[model samples]
Target: MKNIKLTIEYDGRRYLGWQRLGSSDKTIQGKIESVLFQMTGEKIEIIGSGRTDAGTHARGQVANFKTESELSPLEMLNFLNRYLPNDIVIKDVTEMSERFHARYNASGKQYSYYVWNDVIPTAFYRHHSFYVPQELNLEKMEKAAEKLLGTHDFIGFSALKKTKKSTVRKIEEIRIEKNGAMLHFTFIGNGFLHKMIRILTGTLLEIGMGKLDINIIDEVLANKIRQDAGETVPAAGLFLDEVFYE
Candidate 1:
């Protein structure tokens, strides 16, 4: 058996997210598995590095599957690109050692969120980015973003009611940049809790709007209270930028 790793990009406007739900063919994973099954005539199960929420997109999502088929990685890539939906693209594929696991071996991930800070919303790229009419104070947002760097318990920023896993995660970096009316935020971390990035972005935006104090980042981390965080931003604005294994 050969273990194949795939790098994928998708516009998540029409799917139910990355996981394969029972009896549902409208998922990204389900669509890819169906294509693989058609090609190999064998049921193929793939493991993704992580899951993106519904309506969330991906630019470099990684997944791996073990297959008995003799098709080369390039051949498989060609077939997948030809058969998969237009929104989903298999960017690259490579054969790997049997020990390489997509989910278990992932070392870190990078995610990006985009916000259009203009008052006038353009028809183009409406589905890919979030529209916020109010002007944002980029300086205040940058200050707040600095407080979120390093290791902390992100439970306050997450949406999960409970998790057996540890809530403490190390945020390696957080970057905020603006080009004209577009504000972009990028986060690099060992791992992220459910809805963590969305909440962080909302809180930062609130800080930029002068609605929330910049020091509240420290308070929330110290208190570890979910209620202290800001609103959960829309998933449409979020994208899994990359997954790192090494």
Candidate 2:
């Protein structure tokens, strides 16, 4: 048997997220696994680095699966791209050691969120980015985002109801950039809790609009209050940019 690693890119607008649901074909994992089964004649299960919420896109998602098939990695890649939906694409495939597990081996991840910060919404990026008609104070948003960097218990920023695991995750960087009417936010972290990025974006936007105070970031972090954080923004604006492995 051989372990195969796959680099994938997908537009997740129509899928039900990454996990394979029982008897549900409307998922990214299910769609890929189904193709794998067809190619290998086995119920091959691909393990993703992490899950992306519905309507969340991925520019460079990583996954791995062990298979008994004799086909070459390039052959497997070709077969997958040929049959999978147009919205999903297999970018690369390579053979890996049996010890290589996509999730466990991942060291860090990079995510990007896009926002349209103008009154007029464009038909092109309507589905790709979040729109905030009110002008945002970019300077304040940047100042507020700086507080989110470094290690902290991010439970207040996450949507997970209960998790026994530690919420003390480190955010290496949070960059907010403006390109015309578009605002691009990039986050690099060791790991992200459920809905953490969306919540962070919402909070920053609120601060930018003067709906929340810059000092509130310190309050939320210190208090660990979920309700104190801003709303969870739409998933459409989020993207899994890349997964890092060491």
Candidate 3:
């Protein structure tokens, strides 16, 4: 058996979330798995490092699958690229030991969110970023983001109703930058609860627009209530930047 690791990039605009739903072929995993099955003539199952919500794009999403095929890594890469949709690309492929599991062995991940901070609409970034017309108070947003840059219980930030697993996560960094009319928010974390980054960005945007107080970050963290946070931003602005194993 050969464990093949694949680094994939995709524009998730037209698909459902990453996971293969019941009989749903419009998912990232389902699409790729179909191609792999056709290529190897085996029922292939691919395990992704994580799931990105619907319409969320990815620059470097990682996944792995075990197969008994004799194809080399380069051949598999080329074959997948030739058969996969144009929006999806196989960036890299490598053979790994059977001990490697994409989701279980992942150590960390980095996500990026883009905001178009401008009064007029942007042609290039129409589908790439969240458009906010009101001028944002960047300084206030930065101050609010600083309060989120450490280990904490993020139950208040997630959209899930309940989970047996712990909600504590370590956020290594939260970088907010501006270029021209674009506002960029980068989050590097050991792990994230579902919709955590989107909720964080929404809360920060509210702070930027004076809808929420800057000190509300502390209140939300202490309260551990989802209602204390702001809107869940659209998935179109979110990108899976990288998945780390080491």
Tens-digit lDDT string for candidate 2 (1-246): 899999999999999999988999999999999999999999988999999988899999999999989999889989999999999999999999989999999999999999998989978998889999998899999999999999999998999777789999999999999999999999999999999999999999999999999988998899889899898999999999999999
Candidate 1 C-alpha lDDT tens digits along 1-246: 999999999998899999998999889999999999998998999999989888999999999999999999899999999999999999999999999999999999999999988989958868978899987888999899999999999998999877788999999999998888788899999999999999999999999888899999999999888888788989989999999988
Task: Give the better candidate number (1 or 3) by lDDT.
Answer: 3
Q: Compared with the true structure, what per-residue lDDT tens digits does model 3 show for residues 57-96?
A: 9999999999999999999999999999999999999999
**lDDT comparing candidate 1 with the true structure:** 0.93
- Model 3: colliding residue pairs: none
Model 1 residue 3 CA deviation in Å: 0.3
lDDT of 3 at 181: 91
Off by over 4 Å in 3: none
TM-score of each: 0.98, 0.99, 0.99
Worst 10 residues of 3 by lDDT: 119-128
Candidate 2 residue pairs in clash (backbone atoms < 3 Å) = none
Whole-model lDDT, candidate 2? Answer: 0.94
Q: lDDT of each prediction vs. the true structure?
A: 0.93, 0.94, 0.94
